[model samples]
Target: MSITIDPVATAGLVSREVRDGSRDGTPTKIAVARRTYDAEQSDLWQAVTSPERIPRWFMPVSGDLSVGGRYQLEGNAGGLVERCDAPESFAVTWEFGGGVSWVEVSLTPADGGTTLELLHESPVDPDFWTQYGPGAVGVGWDLGLLGLGLHLATGATMDPKESEAWALSPEGVEFARHASAGWADAAIADGDDADAARAAGERTLAFYTTPAPTPEA
Candidate 1:
């Protein structure tokens, strides 16, 4: 299946900012992205929070899914649900590979549809940020949001193998390039050095577009 990159790139607004400290006393930074959906708030909420429907768009999720419960996304992060307010907002601790972060999703009724905002806050690792900037995570979420949009609009079910191939395709490269550039602009707006931000964005773009190394025989 083919996916259009432009609409996904232009469909949302993304921002980044640094925060003081997290629950664990680590310095943190946050990336926020918002996109409007043609679905109703309730429908959007259900699509996001429903474990049964998650795999249809995003990834397969399992585990207790409620306030204070733990949930895991297949081959991805797992965390405890911190808060849940039906059809409006939810917050969770996004734990992955022994590192903990926070993610929150909010839904607002807008223009007869729903506006979905995602906030992902993680402890600042100077090396990582310098090398990749927010595009590391922002582009990831952008892809997820794109998948969500496709699922909502046309009930699309992406084949996993095909999806992996698509990521390295020309269309995917374009999408990542645009997303990384936007993140570079956001970083500059957040007081980063313009040259540094642009350099980091270049690194991020290369990281996403380059093919992975093959295993030795």
Candidate 2:
């Protein structure tokens, strides 16, 4: 699929932060992604929280969507909604692949627009962290922010197949590279070994840009 996105500029739209954290005495890592969109706070909140509109930018999500309710994204994680504050913030559990993490999204009005902040907290898995660093989720959020931007600007629904195709496109690869690098820098700022963090970022870049293999007889 052809894309008009300027990989560098689009990738730069979001700011990233990495930090060491914990929950219930267990070690964890927090990845924060923030982006400001040229849209009203309420409209952006609607786009993110309204089930009918989520698929237009993110993935198709189904299930109960209120506090104490459950939600499942068509091909991604799902869990209970732990907290919700209209046009302000919401927190949810992110359960996938036998792992449970936490995600919180908050919106604030800023400079004639709205800024969205996504915070993901995951239990520290030494092996996985060694292999991928924070880019594991950081780059993914970057893409989501980019999609949200497009949706707000054009009100166009994303075609799942085309979205998948765009990820493997040249522009997508470049964007992933930029995001991965940005996360690596954030990791370094968070006191990670510079070389190790950068190497892990490369692994993440490869993970996103590499296509799956096809089985043949």
lDDT digits (tens) for residues 127-164 of candidate 2: 99999999999998898888888899988887777877
Estimate, for each residue in 71-179, the C-alpha lDDT of model 1 and write its tens digit.
9999999999999999899999999889888999999998968998898898899999999888888888877887888788887775666766777887777777777
Q: What stretches of model 2 exceed 4 Å from their correct place?
A: none
lDDT of 1 at 197: 89
Candidate 1 regions exceeding 4 Å error are 5-25
Superposed by TM-score, candidate 1 places the C-alpha of residue 158 at a distance from the truth, in angstroms, of 2.0
Error of 2 at 123 (Å): 0.4
After the best TM-score superposition of candidate 1, give how far the Cα of residue 41 lies from its true spot, in angstroms.
0.8
Best by TM-score: 2
Best by lDDT: 2
Task: Give all candidates' CA lDDT scores.
Answer: 0.82, 0.94
